[model samples]
Target: MSNLIHFKRDELSFQPYSGQPPERASICRLIGPDASSSMGAGLACFDGCSIEWTVLYDELIVVLEGHFRLRVGERVIEATPGDVIWVPERTPLAYEGDQARVFYALYSVDWQARNA
Candidate 1:
């Protein structure tokens, strides 16, 4: 397998999210197991919407624009630009915010397998 991969700015195409409260955000996947071995990366933008999710793997998210509120059970974390949020597997969480943009890396090889 090749060791080099690149996603140029022009190559990114954000599409409407299929998850709950679809209007909340759009996502553009950059890398996945189809391109790598054990991890995947993507870009997401949210606009004043919240979605409850159960994570299946470890995830690292970095805010790039605006702010985001992550509710993990009873704990709520406010994330701003440059902030990194680490979410562990099997955690039930809710992501909500207004005009938020983030970069995320998920450590899971079967993400696509399950999502697909």
Candidate 2:
């Protein structure tokens, strides 16, 4: 891998997340085990969709545009541009947004290994 990788959002291929409700939710993997050994990074966008997930790894999310909301257990938190949220492993979270673009990084080398 190169020391630096450049990406133009419009040029990246984003796939609809099959695990989530297919209501304009898409993700593009920017870095993973294929790119790095320490962590994985990605960009995700959602609109008018609420989805639940059981996080298997520590994750840091930064809102890039619009409002993004997350229901972590009993706590509800809203994040906007420049806002950052950290979610621990083994947490159950519900996410929803009107229109949001987020950049996320997971502190795990292999999420499937821990999840499975």
Candidate 3:
């Protein structure tokens, strides 16, 4: 069994996307991938911004706070606190958020996902 890891917003390692001033932070302490399948729980912070997303893996997103619109191909999803979204691998998506918006996300790759 793994011990629980705790974290607050801003504690994760930030990944800087091209052309966008770093909008993502990786929360390794609280969650991360494993041999069976890697899982992660992290918070994303955004401001009036837009960025292209090509899903790296499967994801389950829960809005912890703030609001935004998810643009995936031809579909648009309105997301707010308590909203939940499922994203498949290789999907294209982008986000436009209000000032200081944050979303709590749960993600895992195919291999690890099966271990659950």
Q: Which stretches of candidate 3 lie over 4 Å from their true place?
A: 8-19, 22-30, 33-37, 104-116
Ten residues in sequence with the least summed lDDT for candidate 1: 16-25
**Model 1 per-residue lDDT tens digits across residues 1-116:** 67787788787898877563546878998887778788888998888887788988899999999888899989999999999999988899988878898999998957657766
Tell me the deviation in Å of residue 28 in model 3: 8.6
Q: What is the C-alpha lDDT of each candidate?
A: 0.85, 0.85, 0.61
The number of the candidate with the highest TM-score is: 2
- Judge candidate 2 against the unseen true structure and give its global Cα lDDT, from 0 to 1: 0.85
**Model 1 misplaced regions, further than 4 Å:** 19-23, 112-116
lDDT of 3 at 58: 74
Per-residue CA lDDT of model 3 for 39-95, tens digit only, reads: 665556566677677767777777666776778988888888878888887688986
lDDT-best of 1 and 3? 1
- TM-scores of all candidate predictions against the true structure: 0.86, 0.89, 0.67
